[model samples]
Target: MNKIFEESNQVALIVNEFGRFDVDSHIMNQTALSVSMLQGCICCDLQDDLVMQLHQLSKQEVQHVVIEATGIANPIELLSACQDPIISNVYEAPLVITIVDSKRLLQNENTEATETLMDDQIRASHRLILNKIDLLNSDEARQEVIQYVSQLAPYSQIDLAIYGEVKESVKHGQATIDKVNLSTSHPHTHYEVLSYDFTHPISHEQLVQFILNMPDSILRMKGYVQFREFPNEIYLLQYSGGLPALESMGDMKLPTTVVLIGEKLDKPALKNKLELLQFG
Candidate 1:
């Protein structure tokens, strides 16, 4: 999607955990705005920030505003924010696209909970992209996958992709902006969010070990950190889907805070571990 935005010379306003816009000058130059939200589903926890960013973007002479929502986010809840009277006149959620991992969908032991979330995402989308089709061995297998998706999202226009490539026709389809009834409850009501503000710097080694040993239930962990070893540099820490990446942001006046979003998080245990990593 970032590639599409770049090729078409369209501006995007990304909302993510690492405060990526503040750290990367290239991204800042390419994007109209970048704001960081708390580590949770954007639909519930960070809807206000999303709306504020949209309102700000409306003031600019931008042709498009792309919001890159998190994987765990419910698109319906996020789109509901566009109905706000303040921005409804200027903005419209004409389309919602859901991307699915072909490999995951084909897995035999996919949990019931996982299926429920996937179904909700599919039902909400106007279009669906069955990505990573290259993982399947034969056309027959692909057809099976398509059959499963059809059952889940019968109305959505389906597209297949390998290595993230998709047809232009599917990408540029026209959509109608219809108003939807907003719901107060969210699918992630059971999930837990742990947020902490670190006044002192943390030992880099300890931070790495902490992330490496993070509980499997923790779906995402991201925030800004000031490391003792790299006093001059502020690092953005992001961990998702068993992979972690750290990027250096030369310097910033932002708070050294981190937020952990997941299910059934043991808060006391996590807080104790973070306390040990703090540099005295």
Candidate 2:
């Protein structure tokens, strides 16, 4: 096996042959180095030459490759071109984290796609990143990034960092080692959790309409909904870009209140929409 490390790019790419893919040593080292993005997945739609390139690199020894595609259809092509490539079992996979700080420059639509691509970089498992906090001019902007990331990646872990670097408290894979127990440190500010309540039965159509037409200011939307026909029952709705409704068993007495938190949600406008829903 060959290992290729380049300080100029701060990346290592690993390649492996089918017969001798070293799982343990290779991946552990990859994690210890730079933030990595793994691209080969048997269940995914990756190209074969890209796979062979990655295989040859593994045989030679490179660990990670950089991919910044604008119009490229094959996302895995960039990953397959690294030096001594290492193979992983994936079940005990190392985390692939992308650190970003948009400070309102990144559009809401772009935020979802950027995160989706980062998560897609590793198919079998989720990917995480620390949205740099200090870069934002205000505390509110930092919190907005956090809320947006949470909705975009409900299953993945997120850490808050400041001044354009990952925090020492949550470096490498330490934050997501167990995933369920991950937490962020509030070095400069405290975040408050807000809840909006409702006292009426919500219809599926109404709920869908509200989400589809939610203002650009809202970053996250989640809560339970109940239609009159399904009384004494409730359906949970979680949405980022689209919608996923899960059947849930509960008192169904709660309103279809969606707690929307973001950087730009005009409370008065949102309140008007909610008030209308209550009477309708």
Candidate 3:
């Protein structure tokens, strides 16, 4: 979505509690315009907040608006909330895009509930992007992912991406939606998000080690950091499916915070380990 935001000169409203470090990084480089954070998940706590944001954006000269939902969010609930009488006249959802981690899907331990959740996401998407293809070792391995996703969402157009980057043509095109069937009954899946703020600088080596030893229940983590050794520069850390990527953000004025989203997280144990990285 950051790629789309960079390509399209439009306003963006990111809905995340721990500050959208991914969107913030793009805003720092001025590739995006007027990015706003709603500070809660749109699927549950912040539906009204989303309406307010849309109403505010309606007054701006923005041609387009993008709402980046949380990983565990049900997009249908988000869309239904958008239809509220308050902002329905002002904003219309023209497209919905779902980006799938190809590697994660292949490696996921499939339970009945997990399968349902995955299918719901794919079935609701207008455009499906199979991302992290670079992680696949061979052409056959990549094709296997495509085949599996095709069975789930055969109607939607599939595009392969590497490093979360999609082609400009695919980014701008409209998806052909055969139907809009919103499921009334959805299985309740509890996902907890934990946000940590560290004012004191942390050791880069220690941070890497912490991430390496992260619990398997922690599905995704992203945030900005000010390492003691690289105090002059801020780094962005993103971990998904056991793969961690850290990038230098040059010099930027952003908070040093991390947001962890997962199921059955051991918050107390995790907090104790994170405290060890803090400077004395």
RMSD of each: 5.6, 19.1, 3.5
| lDDT string, candidate 1, 24-114, tens digits | 2233444534455644556876788777878887887666776667667777876788777779899755478778777767765434555
How far is 232's C-alpha from truth in model 1 (Å)?
17
The top-ranked prediction according to lDDT is: 3
Q: The CA-based lDDT of model 1 is what?
A: 0.69
lDDT against the true structure, per candidate, is: 0.69, 0.43, 0.71
Which regions in candidate 2 have their CA more than 4 angstroms from the true location? Answer: 1-194, 250-256
Better of 2 and 3 by lDDT: 3
Candidate 3 on 120-208: residue-level lDDT in tens? 77777777888888888998888898778676666667888887776422323234433645583553445666778887889988988
Assess the local accuracy of residue 14 in candidate 1 as a C-alpha lDDT between 0 and 100: 60
Model 3 clash tally, residue pairs: 0
Residue 168 of model 3: what lDDT?
A: 27
Tens-place lDDT per residue, model 2, 1-280, is 1233424333544332211112222223434333222232221233345445444444433344433221112123232322214333311334434454444324455444434443343221234455445556776776666666565455555556654344633212333333322222111111111245667765556666777787654544555566666778766555443333455646734445454534434777777776666566
TM-score of candidate 2 relative to the true fold: 0.35
TM-score of 3: 0.83
Q: Go through the candidates in order and give the clash count of each.
A: 0, 23, 0
Once fitted onto the true fold, the runs of candidate 1 whose alpha carbons sit more than 4 angstroms away are 8-10, 18-32, 108-111, 167-184, 192-261, 266-280
Task: List TM-score per model, in order.
Answer: 0.64, 0.35, 0.83
lDDT of 1 at 243: 58
